[model samples]
Target chain A: MDGTPGGLSGISAPGRVAAPDEGVTEQELALAARNHGLPLEALRYDVTPPGLHYVLTHYDIPATDADGWRLTVGGRVRRTLDLDLDALRARPATTRRVTLECAGNGRARLTPRPVSQPWLVEAVGTAEWTGVPLAALLAEAGIADDAVEAVFTGADHGVERGVEQDYRRSLPLSTAADPARDVLVAYEMNGAPLPPQHGSPLRLVVPGWYGMAHVKWLRDITLTATPYTGFQQSVAYRLRQSAEDVGEPVTLIAPRALMVPPGFPDFMSRTRVVRPGPVPLAGRAWSGHGPVTRVEVSENDGATWTEAELVPDPAHPWAWTAWRTTWTATPGLRRLTVRATDAAGNAQPLVAEETWNRGGFASNLVQRVEVLCTTEATAA
Target chain B: MDGTPGGLSGISAPGRVAAPDEGVTEQELALAARNHGLPLEALRYDVTPPGLHYVLTHYDIPATDADGWRLTVGGRVRRTLDLDLDALRARPATTRRVTLECAGNGRARLTPRPVSQPWLVEAVGTAEWTGVPLAALLAEAGIADDAVEAVFTGADHGVERGVEQDYRRSLPLSTAADPARDVLVAYEMNGAPLPPQHGSPLRLVVPGWYGMAHVKWLRDITLTATPYTGFQQSVAYRLRQSAEDVGEPVTLIAPRALMVPPGFPDFMSRTRVVRPGPVPLAGRAWSGHGPVTRVEVSENDGATWTEAELVPDPAHPWAWTAWRTTWTATPGLRRLTVRATDAAGNAQPLVAEETWNRGGFASNLVQRVEVLCTTEATAA
Candidate 1:
């Protein structure tokens, strides 16, 4: 327990990069085996089925019984509220289609990759989350004037970077109390009870922010007088260029676009193969800064771009926007790329190196696909 | 088209081994991200929820429209029957808790690992699948006398090892016609319409065979006069010792046991930590050969073993058996392991090398966990 960070032994320092050419380690593979990401092609579904939605569980999906679960709201609150599942369900509920993207979405593509979950994009999904608003719960509990942040603690527990504690994260009181933020104590996903991998009994759904802010397997909500300095909040999920730098906290997801890889894919390389003809290319675009205003596609590796048509869905303003375009295919290998720009003027970086960070957070590199078009009448 | 194994360029050979020092390739990582395994801890549930169930999709989870989709029974059948989702669900529905394990469950751990979806021990799950029996459907379709095999085709199309085709595999006509086999045309998982990833519209659920036999996104069932020699049937999923070996086809799941890793896991290494005391260890064991008759635990890395008590569930004969044992722990590092033996006398090998093969199939090595016990009252 000496000065070692998190007081654990045999743990790597936070944000350590793997040596160049070092492949994904067993540790990273173990994490990958436990967690999963959405298949880019699943974008065809407006609301991703819960099973296809990406999942990132830092610890075990705690075995929970909904009937026995209780959520306690306390700390700097005027009146602490302890409620059961039914009690919480009795409140007026609202369902919102919200998109959630992992802060470390494109981590593996980063050079000198940060050795964590090793995600290569695909860490995004949108689902209809149903629950009572967090603002309403806060109102019921009656927040004290001194409360500055709302710290959420989940039931799942494990040691990360030597720190042994339940998974926890905090939101500023300003964000938590704002009704427009649309944060929720979500108990259901896609109209069904939350699956075990998705925090089962109850969880948090913070629309328009990176996934870390939306805590799962929630057990307690404590209003704090001072800012929460937990490990996940103060040390991890930060955009830092170097180990010594105190970086800015990663919050909203950066603007990003991903095309459903056109045509059929090769099993090993996943390179696409298509028959020579007019190829209809379609994909999804999203941003937390604001609604995605524009989406562009490039068939020649970003040398030239064509503005794609955006299919607006007024019902799901917080979910990803659908975009489509047509590409006339001749016989040759082609690199296809897509990028999105949000109303706030935020656009995805053209390459991974541009958004490089020690922790690999907010890496919204443009999505690229290698496609081969052939004249063969029957080619997969 | 040149003499490449599957007529595809830049694709690795069917049974190629990755360089020993090379890390997991981006392509393998992409496959891993798209597919997922159950968290070992999730074994605590009797019936795994649909989202927690393991999935291995050879191609895209084809965007299936249940209303428009149809299942065709043709080939050597007396009458080719085309049925919609409603037609399948309207038949006598039977629900059974079946456990499925990928043939390549422990592929990643093999030395000179197979260059595919690098799975560990998590590639197994049990769910109550609801559907009409395949025997019933085949009986109604009236298989012709010459039919020797029933080839099942899924809608998912892709190129594998240079060969382009829809995902297809076959079962012996005898196996498909046996009512005792309990093969099913599954449309629901855990009482819900199958999730897109699990196979929407309809899927094939072969009760005791390896997951490869359970064709998902089912499109057709063709009763063939001769045995089907498709790529997935004849080349892939075979247990071969060398590249040239024709090898035996992998079918039934080998007996294996996996412990719900004791205590909590370190975030990076996944090493278990526990306070010094009597630690209760529990896990699930299953086999395609027969009901799991015995389970054993080893605290000293398989040096000595003790039998564990098996909790039987009469309803789920094809699902995993629950086993538990208690260990008195002192402060030190210990390697814990578990193995299972089925009624047919099949047992898990002690080391992975014993089960290694060129294609990395059926590697049911014993499950091992490195556990650290400490005197500290509060250690994760």
Candidate 2:
């Protein structure tokens, strides 16, 4: 994705600022930020801190004792093989920075929110994932030609649809074997061994796909000629567009962008009074479809659009790209809207209603930031 | 809904029990219980503790300075009156015990879980609410004959569906004025002034209705000739049965029951293993339609249902009724299911899939409790 840089440098100001909202006080913002596993304030840089990454788990973090941990490759393989943690680690390592997002990230913002995790737009983050290439391990196992899909299963298990089973998903055998896809059997995150909450000993890191495909606390890989009809695979993440439609299996993440919640830099302000003159807005944008090529900002409720300057960070191409824009301050309640376009031509929708799915999957709607600016007289 | 008391006395041995589930360990259960604002161990009491009541708020809780707070009655009313907290308390006071449940409760159990609050069955509790009857307040203001609905507005405000407005809902004037409905302008919860999280100073308590109808932090009562089409009223809580159906507004709580998550009294047990033979199970049952009259328990996945003994607690008509049953144990994995029938003849559904709503509202399916028991030799 390519974009012409605007004059405004989108970097956040030094120190921390509370999220912008008329209802939220500084104290509440701090608690909310802490609750989200991120600073309430937008970061000075675009790439999120590894520790601050958002976490969502259907089950508790598996207490994986690495000493006894093992990975089994079987099913349609020419030769079954089992490897321990050390064995997998010794076979050549690679690290890639990638953005991972929950499929239900923005589900709460949909016109009709479903009855599941009330995730806002914060259920996404980027991190450097280190592991051996999944393709390399698959090659060692020697997949049979008739294999159709590769099933990856995690240690986390729960009951769904009257069936009790571990969390599992299957990718087409061709996609699993594609070297360019950068599929990984990750054991490290951000240069550190994987934390328990993120998947302790081993996990799958599938770039470009939603987090569901990256099964955490991974333990087994089975290849089969038939498509796997497991709960999470065929039933859970289906993107049913309408009542009559059964929905297709959800895959790649959609293009999306988010601005730091607008707020005054100073905590002492009793009112949301923005200083008169040019106001700089900073945030991050990303796309699993492809790199974000352009991000448009709208101050008049999408009545008009202006391009924001994109901050190039080639080191983490799969991570979110930082962007900033300046707006002339006017004394009134202001609502800022943002939409991003990706290289794959997917654009964030103006409204989520059009993209409604039964399971509330892939809800990438235009983000809105509301701010109130008071004149000096009103502020006084 | 009435049935003859069964011989099995469902009284639970005193104290709390962990929820029976193969997947959740004791540690995870504690964390979950803490997150839900409930006691770490599920109790046998039919009435829920006020402090342990579950809470879910769309906007931050309003910091209410009670002295300055005022409730306004206007719109289609003949006279507009501004009443302070003292003025409300000065009027006739009434008390009622009501069970309020979030519409999104039991959402996580849906096979294709929606994206909202990951509420299990814990999103329900009964509390004794003391307040001034709303009908009396509306009478003082002189409701106009042309008024179609009485719209209630809370002080809390936020941006939802791209609009900045106070959280609001409108009830049909007939429903608001019906004395039998027992709608209240509540100021006290369980004999104490309302807690901030439960809506300080004033809130609405609509007995026999979903929690959404009980608007918290209430500030205004506006009578209107037309129905209120606010974000929460028309969109957020609408129970869309399918993509094709626009769905009706969700209201009354459904008939349902839940036993303490079956667990041992001692925390040392790593696995949920119970001694073989007669096992007693106890829980509470409720319904917004009317008092629960019958509760059925099944350990064989609905193959054979047995009646549970109901403890009569009719003093609090709106409160849940305590029930219990004993099941003969076998040395194997056991899935226990419970269902309740309300006085109005509404029964908890056998399958939530049939009653699936796009927003996942009013999901009151039978709860299944899974546990495993081993022979003495295997256990040793």
Candidate 3:
């Protein structure tokens, strides 16, 4: 970890633009090795298999004993409660198919490249999460009237940007107590006990929010009269313009669409090669702001757009909408792109640089795929 | 994918040393996003969970309809048989826990870097695979005396180095027909149907060999009188000293040991930090040559070594052996390394550069990790 030169100095530092020649730093590679994203082709599945779902862990997955694990709820509560797995399982369970995306999904595409996780557009996935509604637990614990925020603490402890702490995030008291929000203390993913990587035993599932708010290995929840100013909440995951100015906190995911890359990919360049004919292009689209209302495709890099058929799953409103279209590819190089507009009217930026920020949060740039159509017969 | 500057020209060109100032190219990042490696901390589990297992797909995960899929065994056989899922499932099934490591496992660690998948040491995982033995299938088809090799073809198709073709590889007739080898036409992984990324429906699982021999999405098996010289076989996955050197063909896995990186990691650098005390460290080790006979740990970067206790699972002979040791931590920084030796007398090289090759295949260099021990109380 020493003297291996590539990018900036130090283990964790404030965000900055990488030098023109600087390749991905070893630190970034280390993070990429531990975490993974959904393979874009996996967009074919409506309920992403747990293994195919994207994962981003801030620290080592803490070894946990499920039977002995307990969730403690205390601060500013009328009655502090400690609940084990069995106790939580005995409560009514709710399941929802939800899409989760990392706030830094398109960070690598940013021109200067935020010196963090160098993500492309693959950092999103959809899974069915099952657990007891968090609102029920708060009611049982009897939140105090003076409580203004609820801070959820996870068992995963680590350092980020030089600050050592347990991973923690807070929600406004109103949002935490709202039954319509449908937040859950998730214990299962895709019908099985959560795998260790997905936070075995228990975790938090905040619908329609970026992954940071859905803390894995959840251990405790504390209600506070004042805002929780932890590093994760106050410093990281924020959309900042520069070093001095405080930026807006990244929350709901912006609308975005990514296609299952057409044809087969070249092992190295990932340039798609398709036979000269009608190629069916399909993809998944989603938004945290609201349901995706329209999805459009462009074969000439967004010069002209055509609407695709949208098929939204009513049973899983929080999950992504499946869209499909057809293109008659000719013998030439083509750059294909896709974008989504939510019911709330927010659309993805045309390019990653449009949404660039120091922390590289929520840059839902439209996905562009390069395809070469040839008539030469090949082996298959 | 155009105009993205960083590395060498033209996608899928022959390997070469990257300039010192060159950062990871977008082409490499595309490959990294699609293929993922096992998380080091996941070593805590005996059988890595399906999702945690490392995956390297040569092309897109071909979508297969299990009910309609067929396995065709033809060419130089007494009888060409097309067996469907039901027909194959009716055959006697065998299950075994096997460890699969990519031939290019440590490619990224090499000095020049192969510029392929850019994998670190995490490109390995152990899983329980169940299916009918390949020897039984070959026996049923009745091999011809003149057949020198058995070619396995998969449904995955893509262009590599400008040649478009289906993914295919071949094994010697003797190796394919030897029941003692226990080669399997596997359909299940970790007690469940194979995940799409892992080759759904059916795939080949050859024990003791690198992952290339285990063809995924297997569709056809053709016997031939001559050795198969496909792109993946003759052009790629070969060890070469330079452009002109044909080099030895890569096969068996080399002995290697990787510890579960101790303590919590900083998000970006992954530099581990631990409290000053006795720290218990554990990891998994294995080799294609034979069972790991010994594991040694070095806290001062190989200045001195200490033997660790080895625990091999008798039931899973082809899987990795577990090893553990404890280190007394002082208040400072330390470089820790681990190496393994197999019963076959093969040992890992001390440095990655010692095993460097043009293709970056089978560079099982020793594992090195750095840790910081501090007495200061932190937030967590």
Candidate 4:
């Protein structure tokens, strides 16, 4: 056996040591291939732009022309300024890789799934966002001490919660003006001009917050003395702790992990079966609140837990951490689940039922998988 | 079972089906965990900085502080300019994520492994490189038609092939001045200043090329009227096609695929055993010459092949593609192998013996892995 890259020796070399046993069904071999490492089809693993971006607008996207696009900063500011696309691009541009996830990403996992956009975990993605920092523009406008919030408005208009309005959300003035936050008015995604589905021309990207804070098709930024009680801010994304509790606006993404489903593909294809043996599993874990500190996998239905290996470098402070583990098999069926814990000591729940709200948001549940294994005799 | 994210309903849910006959042993359960996915300790998989970076230097790294660092441009130029780190940063800066690999990576796999920094597959890594484009710097110095190549010299000096000189390599003048090539005089790695081992203040990063082209601790750029015959360029990295052939200078990386070894961990730990059934495997595929188009995995010693799923978005034009596949098993030792085919039609060979160089560089051999699978009865 040859030594590994790290100088570890005595490991066996790769190649066939034995042939397949006689009468092993052709279907079984295909099944093994099909059910291989994490199912790509089931996961939104793409971190680059222009891939499968989770579209969840209240209305159809409005076609915006670059010439017509303008960003206006007014309200509780010393100066009201209107700038075109070119003007914004002329500013000092900074690029950062950030992970954005829908606040309602795992809503479909709820028993009585919400009636709105039915999203599973695939609604999350990461990309390189390049543009002027929002703090720079806000600094030019000069904020008033009385301003409590900064409201961001998009061009897409629709009726929501019995109110006709453009898509808008507000951030606390502190979050809007904090340079360390790295919030940006983004015009590019993954080094290319933003696609129509992702905010084109301009969009407000509040890094470390859920997707709602990223107001796409951005048109205006308004500061106000009181908090903006917009439909999206005060109504849609509120997370209720219990039936009697008044919900609070959901902002940061909780610690969460999703294993690549077995047999994940680079592209969609037919399903394959699995043989019973040593199965390697992998997935990504992330937290909007803090860097993920640990991830654990449960093979006996969460009865006992073991730590999974986390990819050390988290690309970005806000990007997801890749992880892996294994599940040995017995010839029947088995359930595999994964949980994540963040630096803030927040651990993902076995079931995300506790965070369920009227809007069915913030479901960081322990994701589970079930697969069948067959013995050689039973298969043949 | 609920439908997968892609809305495919035919897939079955995961869980236990039936109990195995009185044979399966507890050791098999441990095997499942040990070979979980990509043996982290065995490979360098850091996508972020401060992780394991492959180091290969002929001499001691020259400790040059930024205060003393000066880049000089001369030879065949209308203007010779010497600039320091501060002056270099004054120019427009661009950041790109690119993968870098040693030309001698996988050199350990050669039949008669050459005497050098023995690298297996783990000598490769990807990082966000930030710096000013070399084209901009060259444009300032102006080039003449007589200039055929630009020689880049690093601070380290050593004796190689009976000559004592600083590390140096050259690129064609056209390639050195092409902005589309995305070459950079990189000063930062993964958002932070370059670490001491990674070139400290400055390095030359030629995207889509082997690590030898990235001259660390860069100090001088000399425009040459003819081809460079430096020891490194003439002897070390030359890829000889055959005994009588004059090997050309190696530039782009070949198509290669590496699977995360079963029992991969964040850190090295005890080896685990395997059960009898299906096993899932995954790894990364990449090519410096072109984007990886396809990857195939062979579980039965290469008797038959199956297409493994590739990670859809490559994140960068030059980044590696993630892939996965599965193996159905009978209770015995097994060998698994993976190969990558690039858009250029360059496929990894089953045996890399043909490409073996006297210096043992560029070994894209079809990687083989050996594993053991035991039945409950035999294992117990």
Q: Mind sharing the TM-score for model 3?
A: 0.96
Ranking the candidates on lDDT from highest down gives 1, 3, 2, 4
Model 3 agreement with the true structure over B261-307: per-residue lDDT tens digits: 99888777787887788999999999999999999999988889999
What would the C-alpha RMSD of candidate 1 be, to one decimal place?
2.1
Error of 3 at A157 (Å): 1.1
The better candidate by TM-score, 1 or 2, is 1
**Model 1: how far residue A48 lies from native, Å:** 0.4
lDDT of 4: 0.66
| Ranking of candidates on DockQ, top first | 1, 3, 4, 2
- The DockQ of each candidate is 0.54, 0.01, 0.50, 0.02
Question: Taking the tens digit of each residue's C-alpha lDDT, what string does model 1 give over B1-380?
Answer: 42433235544245488897888888889888888999989899888877788989887889889989999999999999999988987899988899999898999999989888899889999999999999999999998999999999999998787778899999997889899999999999988898888888789999889999999999999999989988898889898998889999999999999999888877778888787889999999999999999999988888889999999998789899999999888766788989999999999998789999998899999988887675433332
The iRMS of the candidates, in order, is 3.2, 22.2, 5.7, 29.1
- Give stretches of model 3 more than 4 Å off: A1-11, B1-17
Candidate 4 ranges beyond 4 A from true positions: A1-46, A241-245, A264-272, A375-380, B1-380
Quality of candidate 2 docking, DockQ: 0.01
Q: Considering every candidate listed, which one attains the maximal lDDT?
A: 1
- Per-residue lDDT over B85-178 for candidate 4, one digit per residue giving the tens place of the 0 to 100 score: 9999899999888777778776645655453444445566678899999999899999977998999999865434323357889999778999
Alpha carbon lDDT at A258, candidate 3:
91
Docking quality of model 1: it rates as: medium
Q: List runs of model 2 lying over 4 Å from the truth.
A: A1-46, A242-244, A265-273, A375-380, B1-380
| Clash number for candidate 4 | 30
| C-alpha lDDT (0 to 100) for residue B244 of candidate 4 | 53
Per-model TM-score on C-alpha atoms: 0.97, 0.50, 0.96, 0.45
